[model samples]
Target: MLIAHIPGALLGLLIGNIIDRNLAIKSWADLRTRLPVRAQPQLNAEQVLFMLLGHLAKSTGRVSAAHIQSARAEMQRLQLSAAAQKRAIAAFTQGKDCALTDLRSALRSHYAADKAEQLLTAGWRIAYAQGLATAKQRRILQRCADWLNYPAASFSRLEAQLMPTRLRPNSAGNELEAALQLLGVTRSTSLAQVKQAYRRKVSVHHPDKLMGAGAPPAQLRAATEKTRALHQAYALVRKHLQG
Candidate 1:
């Protein structure tokens, strides 16, 4: 009887150990999930917009009068009052000379996904305001898009919208080149190169991936569209290569 009781006691101890270990694992996971989010300093939308405008202007090598005027127009459209306009202007001036870190922080803290989208659009308008975008403007715009966390395909689509084209939207011929540009490759690009670029894009915009990276719900739709566009671009490239 004592021998039988000893085995039963050992079984009870084993069960207790298992329960304790499971509870500990759960507690650690909860602690990790509940880890506090670092608060970003609050920033004014108008000020951030102009600062970004300033940063882009410098990207093209000169903050021209036209550039400044375009920013002023955006300010007016936003209905900023005289005092607010001055503040925005001040931010723009300061931002022009500020380091890249400041610009990036402002973007991360001040703008949500939709606002970031609008800012990208505003950039094209500003660039196109003086006619066709220069090579420098295009290059700088791409860099700005990167800093703003805008996907390559989304950047291409937005930039294409402002460009003059006789072909209707969704025309295969038009999309072929745009698709190449979106993938950050050219016509002469190898299939391997295209695939690599496509995978990089997918990693950046996948929903589970973005959510894990703390992407907001508003941006999840953007991520979805980016992923779709990437698929389209890759499909076009693969078909072209096969043919």
Candidate 2:
């Protein structure tokens, strides 16, 4: 029997190569384990908006018919397909069940400034669906605004802009104040200043402009209401000033 063997140096070199290859493979695996993972996909703006609306509706302990109606109105305005509407409902339901912190985090992750403002406007509409926002609803909405980097004052302003007409103050003094606030002016402001403010508010809240901007039907209605309020406010202010 003849036994053939490779030289010791060649065998040693082959063994070294195999060891190096194994080490390289192990290093790659270790690096992979250490690498940052891709984050879970964040919810989109519509989902977050609907979820927040759901959370807002449930904030006071029970969801009301008005809240459901408001959500449906938003869906209609969006012209969502039947499947998308179903998803919106699911997201809203999830919002009712999910933690507030989770919803806030999702909102912050998914929405930019303008879009976040629009979502917050929708939230205000939902909160005011039954005329006025309850304390719990206001707190939830304020927290959401804060999460989106909107100041508390801005939240209050937005709330004022969307306040239900039937719920607005009817007293002479309060009406005057609300008018001034709506016009972004004050009693001390000159008539010229008041006119400027009124025009500015009208331009911003005009239903035509809102519609042109692709605002939903619900938003258009809100804008129309706001415009009407602005006219009333302007007239009241002008009357008070002229007299």
Candidate 3:
């Protein structure tokens, strides 16, 4: 009887141990499921720029051919690789689909001053892609600029400075008009005012100055083009005024 009782006791103890082990394993699995997952990485500045560009492109009811061309031009300017270009296109599409709240959330992270300025500049370029920005486009750009912590005054200045100059059939008049627009002056403006505007534009857009301010290489290249345009504009405008 004692021997029988011993075997039964041992069997019961073994079953209890097995049940405890199974419970322990189940608890661990449940805890794992409840634990927080690591989030995906955030978008970088270039991606964000492209996204904003797409967003601005679609602001005026629908995206136009000019907007597509402008976005392609930006992709070329950035010299994006095939993979990067694909990613940019995807981001642009996402931007077109996303709400303004999503854009605000995406831009919530802080960027360096120069970087912020560069992004804002890109946004302005896209906004003015259709020769002139529509009211909706301007409003969208203003909101984006505010989100980027870019100054409202600076945004207005950029709009004034970067607006595309329209060319007519007259070659000489076209050149003169473009030059004047680039300098932010008019044909009747005094020589002194033109000179002052030229100086101000040069000071703001000089490549060396931008580089010193920690602007990226792309911005420096753009600054170089801008500085050259300013010089040429000043030369033509100066000659026209003096002559």
Candidate 4:
């Protein structure tokens, strides 16, 4: 094959451009990966709560007044107004009639992972609101967590926090487990990874961002507890690293 060689400068420019293009693409990808987890803008928030609460309540096979009340508490937690509450009630009624499989499909397709996690957390509160979660409800919650593709450890952490009755007080093992889970990191994670997780979680739940997005006053209030929890968890992680 007879090769017509390009000028050295032209070849150098072509290689440089290729490298620049690759770096740009990589930087864009990194930027996207670093973006904070956020709610689903397109999904209706009240309806999502209704669907999640309804599905969770029904998962126990018999929805109790307590379960219904817990759902209401979620509305209270979200600070829904009277009209919004009525709409949520209607959605909850619809959710009660839904099959678990159908709700799972809807949740997975309609919301971002973070939004889905928020909805599922609401479900957990309802399930545990009676002071303990039933075996069936726990099973259903675990399955739903799997469907959401959340880390099992993270789910365990939330589960533990909600059901402190199940844990012995001041057990470092339990506390450490809970802390790692809250930070969304495994025990094997490095300190840098722990810090990164802490920052990411804080960014996602920042008061200004949620308030600016029209999150309810109650929800903002609830975020204070979450923030405190994050700080405690980070402290535990830091202690473990220093030790």
Cα RMSDs, all models: 26.4, 19.0, 18.4, 27.4
Residue-wise lDDT of candidate 1 within 38-136, one digit each (tens)?
A: 886566877777776777677667788888898888888889899998998998887688765566666766554666678777777677655577786
Provide the clash count, candidate 1.
Answer: 0
Using all chains and alpha carbons, the TM-scores for the candidates as numbered come to 0.46, 0.53, 0.52, 0.47
Alpha carbon lDDT of each predicted model: 0.78, 0.85, 0.80, 0.79
Model 4 local distance difference test score: 0.79
Q: Which of candidates 2 and 3 reaches a greater lDDT?
A: 2
Where is model 3 poorest over a 10-residue stretch in terms of lDDT?
163-172
lDDT of 3 at 148: 71
lDDT of residue 183 for candidate 3: 92
What's model 2's TM-score?
A: 0.53
lDDT of 4 by residue, 84-191 (tens): 899899888878887777666666775547875686678778887665677877887787788888788988888877664544466787799899989999888999
Please identify which of the two predictions, 1 or 2, would achieve the higher lDDT against the true structure: 2
In candidate 2, stretches whose alpha carbon ends up further than 4 angstroms from where it belongs are 1-41, 171-243
Better of 2 and 4 by lDDT: 2
lDDT of 1: 0.78
Model with the higher TM-score, candidate 2 or 3 = 2
